[model samples]
Target chain A: MQFVRAIVRPEKKDEVLENLSSGGFNAATVVDVVGRGKQKGIRMGDIYYDEIPKTLILVAIEDADTDKIVDIILRTAKTGTDGNFGDGKIFISPVEEAYTISKGTKGL
Target chain B: MKEIMAIVRMKRTGATKRALIEAGVAGFTAFKVTGRGKLLDHSEINVPCKEKLMGMAASDVIDRKESEEQVVTFLDDKRMFPRRMFTILAYDEDVPRIIEAIIKANRTERGAGDGKIFVTPVNNAVRVRTGESGDAAIW
Candidate 1:
């Protein structure tokens, strides 16, 4: 199993979630977090927003489905054709184990 | 690549950030978390004496019998303290320096609850905009 964590712009959250659901990956955990990327942050006329709000979507899927799910997020989360600075990034990691709480069953 | 997760006292977050930045870390994510360590401070359990509750002075309560003591009960004994968790993704070579920086910023003479540091292997990282992966993506 692979654990995919995507941090995307807040506005694109629903679109990304919808796309993921339609892609047959419905189970996910979403959290509202504030952080900066390589650009550090953005600066306006007289204000500097050091902590930009973003949405984190977490999903656990079969290793073979990694590329498919990543593609779904990359496509739906991008702002424009070429993408923007805050388009967000996706991270893939190995999942050692998973368990179903109610049923006490293991594996996802 | 490695992911360094440092949990430190909330008040030391700024110091930790500065330390990480000075150590040449590109970027990191931080969030507020509440957790408890293995060692619990008994003094915080809040077991008030009956004499104090009855309006008796401290000196008078010292001579009081143990039966007069009142122990407050609660649903749970554990207390969670607020902390700041910093998640930093960096190259393998940079892990040691980053960990040192985080420890220096948060460590104090006081023992325990100083927080902890966890290092985990990252399978891969992707830069969404450029479609870059591996070391090329992280920097």
Candidate 2:
């Protein structure tokens, strides 16, 4: 299994989650996070919004499902057809092992 | 650089924090989260959520269904436990030390729910205040 971590604009979080659930991958952990990237931060006419709010969505799925899930996130998280900076990013890492606490079993 | 995320018991958070700081790693982020380990016995409970947030325009809140996304659900199972996810961004050399500190502080003889720790490569990180990137940003 691989863990998929997506840092997305706060507004797009729900859409991403909805897509994931409808696509049959329901288990995911969502956290409220703040970060800035290459653009550094955004500037309005008068003030700068330095720490932009983002939602970090964590999901562990079968290795085979990686592409599909990533696709769903990318499709749903982007701000528009052209995409924009701070649209957020997705990271995938191998999960050595996973266990279920209640059943006391390993590998899921 | 590598990021170490340890999800341990909420009560052990203080000890874990102390251990990390004592290990010479001062900055870290912690969040309160609810999850179930190997048990796989929990059920999801859907809680009602409104389609549009107070400050958002009705058109801005995409109408996917019932006006709100089903993403805002809660776990209804008693078996699901609450855990704290402690995240640390450090240089490559400090990864092992930080992980060790977490295990030493959170692992108890009582067993099982000591929580899980995972290390992942961070392609890059930036210090928002300084506009520094990579190792310079974290160091």
Candidate 3:
């Protein structure tokens, strides 16, 4: 199974969750996150802030389902049209094994 | 416009999840994450990718799949799609201790694993049910 770690604009969470759920990947959890991008923190008028907040959406799916889920997330999350700074990032990685506590069995 | 999140590398979080809940992290999410960090901080991975090139270029791979373009598409079409993967989320103040607990739990099995923690800020938030604010939603 592949795992997705998405950092998106916090405001986009609703749309993201909606798309993910409507797309048949309903099981998800959202967390409040903070960090900065290559912009090395943002600078508005004159404030020098180092940390930035982001919403992290975490989910796991079968290999066959990776593409669809990614599409849904990107469509709903990617904000800047010209690749602006800190538009958020998505990380996909492999999961070695999974276990369901309620079922007490390994997930395939 | 601020969020508090932490990436804590832990050994297989069998019960650590439940522990997080008990610690007052009402609704939390977790994913099977892998890191080159302290090997002691490991989790059970279900699907393993033999060949992997992560970070910046990974995004480019998504945009370049179709059409006649040597440079590839700007936005990769397959980054967050299938809505499948490993991940978990929790509240702010709940992080430090929870991750600490996670690290402690991992340490029980492995010793002094190398790992780094990161925290980032969020711009806005919406609570699906009643449409609450970030602070009100979690705090």
Candidate 4:
């Protein structure tokens, strides 16, 4: 199994979730987080905001399905044609074990 | 690559950020979280809050010393405290530096709740903009 975590702008959260669901990867955990990327944060009117609000979407899926899911996220979460700073990044991590709570079954 | 996750006191976030930057880390994500440690105080758990509440009326509970004690016990039993978690992705060679930076910034000589640092292996990272992967992606 693989754990995929994507951090995207708050405004693009819904669109990304919808696309992921339509792609048949439904189970996800979403969180509101504040952070910055390579560009650090943004400035407006002489004010520097270091922490920008972003939505973190987490999903656990079969290893084979990783590419498809990454594609779905990248396509839906991108801000524009070439993309911009703060467009967000996707990380893939190996999942050692997974279990279904209600069913008491193991694995993804 | 490794993912360094550090859970530290909320008040120490600024120090941690500066430390990470000075250590040459490019970016990281932080979240406000509530969590508790495994070491539970047996003394506080012995006196249940419900029994204390039963000893006094609801209105008088506010002014009584026993009520204040009860509130403390309740909080001790629940034990959850606000913490800031920083998640940083870095190359294998950078992991040690990042971990050291986090520890130096957040560690207190006091007891538990100084927080923890977990290092996990990352299979891959992708930069959405340029379609770069691996080290190129993280930097």
* DockQ-better candidate, 1 vs 4: 4
Clashing pairs in 1: none
Which docking band does candidate 1 fall into?
incorrect
Which is better, 1 or 2, measured by TM-score?
Answer: 2
Decide which is better by TM-score, 2 or 4. 2
The global Cα lDDT (0 to 1) of model 4 is: 0.73
lDDT of 2 by residue, A1-108 (tens): 788989999889778877787787766666788888888699898888888998888888788999999999999999878999999999989765454322334445
Off by over 4 Å in 2: B1-29, B34-82, B87-139
Per model, the share of native interface contacts recovered reads 0.00, 0.00, 0.00, 0.01
Compose the digit string of candidate 4's lDDT tens values, residues B8-87. Answer: 78899999999998999869999886554433445444345345555554774556777666666654423346778788
Model 1 chain A worst lDDT window (10 residues): A97-106
lDDT: worst 10-residue window of model 4 chain B = B37-46
Weakest ten-residue segment in model 4 chain A by summed lDDT: A97-106
Instruction: Please list the Cα RMSD from the true structure of every candidate, rounded to 1 decimal place.
Output: 13.3, 10.7, 17.7, 11.9
True contacts kept of 4: 0.01
Which 10 successive residues of model 3 chain B have the least lDDT summed? B45-54
User: Is candidate 2 or 4 superior in DockQ?
Assistant: 2
Across A25-67, the per-residue lDDT of candidate 3 in tens digits comes to 7555456778988878978889967788888877767789988
lDDT of 1 by residue, B1-139 (tens): 8877666788888898889889999599888765444323344332333224445435555645442433222112133456776788888888767776776777664444566665667889999999999989887
TM-score of every model? 0.46, 0.55, 0.45, 0.49
DockQ computed for model 2 against the true two-chain complex using alpha carbons:
0.13
Would candidate 2 be rated incorrect, acceptable, medium or high by CAPRI criteria? incorrect
C-alpha lDDT of residue A56 in model 1 = 81
- The sequence of per-residue lDDT tens digits that candidate 1 reaches over residues A1-108 is 777989999899878877777787755556678999888799898888889999887677789999999999999999879999999999987754443322223455
